[model samples]
Target chain A: MGLVAVTWMNCLGRCLPQKTRFLHTLKGRQSDQILMSPSLASLDLPDTWTPNSSCQSIPDIRKSFNEQTPTVIDGKLMATEIRSKIADQVRQMKKCLGKVPGLAVILVGQRRDSLTYVHNKIIACEEVGMKSVVTELPTDCADADVQNAVMRFNKDPSIHGILVQLPLPQHLDEEKILDALCLEKDVDGFHPLNMGNLSLRGREPLFIPCTPKACIELLIRSGVKIMGKKAVVIGRSNIVGLPTSLLLQRHHATVTIVHAFTENPEQITSEAEIVVSAAGVPSLVRGNWIKSGATVIDVGTSPVEDPSSEDGYRLVGDVCFEEVKKVASVITPVPGGVGPMTVTMLLVNTLDSAKRMLNFT
Target chain B: MGLVAVTWMNCLGRCLPQKTRFLHTLKGRQSDQILMSPSLASLDLPDTWTPNSSCQSIPDIRKSFNEQTPTVIDGKLMATEIRSKIADQVRQMKKCLGKVPGLAVILVGQRRDSLTYVHNKIIACEEVGMKSVVTELPTDCADADVQNAVMRFNKDPSIHGILVQLPLPQHLDEEKILDALCLEKDVDGFHPLNMGNLSLRGREPLFIPCTPKACIELLIRSGVKIMGKKAVVIGRSNIVGLPTSLLLQRHHATVTIVHAFTENPEQITSEAEIVVSAAGVPSLVRGNWIKSGATVIDVGTSPVEDPSSEDGYRLVGDVCFEEVKKVASVITPVPGGVGPMTVTMLLVNTLDSAKRMLNFT
Candidate 1:
């Protein structure tokens, strides 16, 4: 393992810049040097050094990475562009058919994050000229109340997409409520049938989960080639990691999934050309865990206490951003990365669902 | 790469026997050496040799490998044992509820292979004291004819399981016919809903696809640990490769799928501790593609013309078995491997379905 790691690092270091040009073109951003903590900058070690070395004798080599330029993927910029296009399409649909896409959201509880998410989704729908509806129920609401809300939305012809806010109250049966949702209006794409279709080769899902869709959209729009690449997706949650891994295979990437149970994850991860971390653990993926010239999509967002922020907390992703950016050819920043694209993709899905329903295409 | 290959060979060579002892106990078979051709025996290389070496100077090392004893996983023996248990349970069900499990198969057209598969399923059903029914249609039959047959079985109270024989005349709508199958009686587990449930983390499919289930059964029953292991599944077909990969992940193995579009599949495969090849190509996976002491499950079966056989053809697997057995810690042979286990698993699904329906434990 030691010998192989050395050979891989040397080979990748020589080929890094040439392979990263395509990804750099997607953002049109020049690589710039930034200061990082010396504690986490393991990738800055000298070529003669190995992973087996003790840190006590090693000299700091962070100064050598001053010229290391990696493209910081701009997800917020991409989301704005997509939203503008969707708004144009929604206007065109309204002019032709006198009706636009409609999204219905069901929020069962008062969790602050869930409330903010639901509010953001509603605002996003409105920004794109789509009708929005929200049904807020008490935390102690019966299972029938949630099912009733879903059934009502399912029958409404005006609604093109419907989503039940996740992490429902502990008393309610989440699976049963989700199962009651109409497959057509399941814009969240949490339905098992939609997931099954996504997993199968010839079958197509009606709607892909927004976060996974967002990750793929970011990759494609950034000019990254997916076919035949070795991709390692950390975590296997159904909503993100599992579907993203399945989606990558659909795009012809040989994908490996590294979850909590996987042994020697860094060794496996270091071999991937594409790394997507969705484990929701902050700074879990370090610099040495990444291969040079790899494109990293960080989907993990966990709240960390920050006295400087208005809310006294801020979001951090799975990748140690400062250290990883110097090593990765392309990397997405936590707050402005996959976070902004999810709601935008929901709008895309809603528009698509409406177009299909109205037979306007 | 050369340096690392030599190091890996030495390390695995020293530890192979101990790591394989648990799997060997599953069959209680003594290590017996067998003769092999000189051409494919690549693992008998000396410690100083690397993968970069030219073949001309190497002397024959076949005699040294005469002591290599790998446990041949006997799927036929396991299937027989499982079927006997199911038979005893079926008799108990008859005594308690005055009814036994029933399997209904719908066969379209007269494809010889399909006919043989259906016949074998029926015989297996009878051998376990279950009622069996077959519905055959002509090659030119209309779509509704197949649907009607499926519907009849769906409505029959005595039937606990239903399966539509695959590769139905190419003109027939295979997906639509499968979609018509009732989920409860979908013993083949080809329905999209069942597949969807299987893919979800918290959801459970009513039945798992038989072939993939058979592969897992072989691994588990043989005392092979799946958790925290690396598994490579070579193929992306919906039926075998895809599901087996999903099942392996569910068992907590970090899994990678190698399909036709994948580059350097051998490199990815050589890193795995578990390799399941379902590519259906004859000898597609060679000796050098596997790591020492890996547990190889070959689900590939393609018939090759053989004048010595009574049928004028013999079945061969994806792995070059003669070569792989020398390196693999545990291996399953072509004729008696996963083939028999598929039918047996179908029986298990049927009996479980019957028990669920009859409210029996």
Candidate 2:
């Protein structure tokens, strides 16, 4: 423990020594120096000093893996709570409006992952007492075919929300197809009009983008404070990183984004109290890079070779989970973390869309 | 000058010494001292470094008191050049296609500034050999009136672009009026559809918002070297600051935005090689706060008391001009700089709209 403290102090001294020297000095002498004092008059300094040490020397403390256990936040559990809340709201809406909310999911191809994801989304919708419809198209379907399906759902009064599974066939224009959905039923909030409204300060989109909203909810459910905290989002992809940063900024968090071409990515990520890693580059963020006790929401879900696994493949996030768990106060695991919550959020969004369409809220 | 430099260094040391030391060492000596550098340096260092001192520090460079410093990139002159280019293109289109580009300017209120701006736009349209039409409505005009005007422009084949002067009457729904304009003919780029397209990566709007475009043109004309430079935008207004930051980012400059709620605003602003201030707060950024030889674009147009002027009012930018001029290498003076370029860019957009409609380009 003493050696760990010493190395942690040295590491912090290397990174933020000038800013932390005064507190570090107090921390270095606190145990021995406080005992020698005639009275316990200066204990307040120890309290403040310890937190700083924990924050600045996260890497060193995490090295003692056996001693420091990682706190695993159950994103699945939090997502279930949200779903239950949405279900309750849906039940009330049904009693009031005599109509149930419905969601239409359009899958363009038979990509196994997309099929599995669509299946899970349908299950989630059913779990939350919402009607779900799935429309499948051939891999070589024309743009007009996709557009026609979207128009059909748009005009269907029973369908309150519409979602198109992503990574559409390479031949199709994804942007044009996504924009074709009626903005009113764009529960996924990927429609250009909804995205534009979300970017504006005073205007709130009828449906907040699902993944970013789920990330925020996960952070709050874990009791991680967000107001006035510094958050860094690594990636600026429109789907996840950019919108996530904007949502965090709306909550008054000072936010910075480090994208692919960003120089010194580690330095920027290290400064954040809340880090959202959506870069999709497996193991891009290591344990040593995070601030001690910082909350990490790992949004990446890349499949990597895992010979030991039954399927011979395993899902991983952008952060080095094994390493990051040691330092992060609350960390979301890759496969069961943001992925499950994402599907669950779609259900919530569908229900909300239904409520809005039925004028239940 | 040496004494000024020393005093400036001392002040920087006292105010943000960690940042100053980190920047000096990082830029001064190109070594990987990532872990050893101060936290301030880690936070304040721009993602990219520009070698030219003047280009890096616009707000702190010495200003030329000589009234005829012709070397300065005159925005007014460049705007004329752009207007002439548009005029030539319009003339060629008329000769080849047998039709002129038409622009419709809708003025909803009697605001003096809006009226003056609209009049200049109409004049610019005429100067470019494009057709111009003006529609005036009373201050108390209903929202339906504005929407009708936009719909009329949408249906009129001859009207290529429709621009409704901003700060519309309070009674009128601004969003509704802006959204009514045909997406293709939305010259102001304020429509949600255009904004959505702008937010998407690699997606270009049919027309960009004028002031931000003008700011970029000003920098380019001055040879400020945007590629891989550190750019900081102070403020996040949808019109100027946010869009300008995005444009700079698109040009491959590492961009950071410092808004009203940003902590350590000076710490972030002073690190950038190029600074764009559009906060609308007078003197929010002081001279010493600027990087030496950086290019400063003052987008704020605030009216301040000036006994020397006959009207007892003077137009000023968000930056404190007299002080910053001594440190900045090149700066856009409030009234003549960005202001003139904005009006001129609007004409350019209108002209482009006309050319597209006329099948000229």
Task: Please report the candidate that would top TM-score against the real structure.
Answer: 1
In candidate 1 chain B, what residue range of length 10 has the lowest lDDT sum?
B32-41
Each candidate: RMSD to true structure?
13.7, 15.0
DockQ of each: 0.22, 0.10
**lDDT winner among the candidates?**
1
lDDT of 2 by residue, B257-345 (tens): 76654545565666567899988877777875577777899998867778898657777778777777877778888777987788777
lDDT of 2 by residue, A1-361 (tens): 2332332233223333354544534543433221111111111111111101111111222222243666687877767777777777777777888788899999998876677789888888888788889999999999999999999999999999998898889899888888789988988888767766766654567777888877876775566655446688877777887778767766545576766545445655665678998887787888766777778999987778889987677778888888788777788987878888888777767776776677666
| TM-score, every prediction | 0.82, 0.77
Q: What share of the true interface contacts does candidate 2 keep?
A: 0.15
Q: Stretches of candidate 2 above 4 Å error?
A: A1-72, A93-98, A223-228, A325-330, B1-72, B310-312
The Cα RMSD of model 1 versus the native structure comes to: 13.7
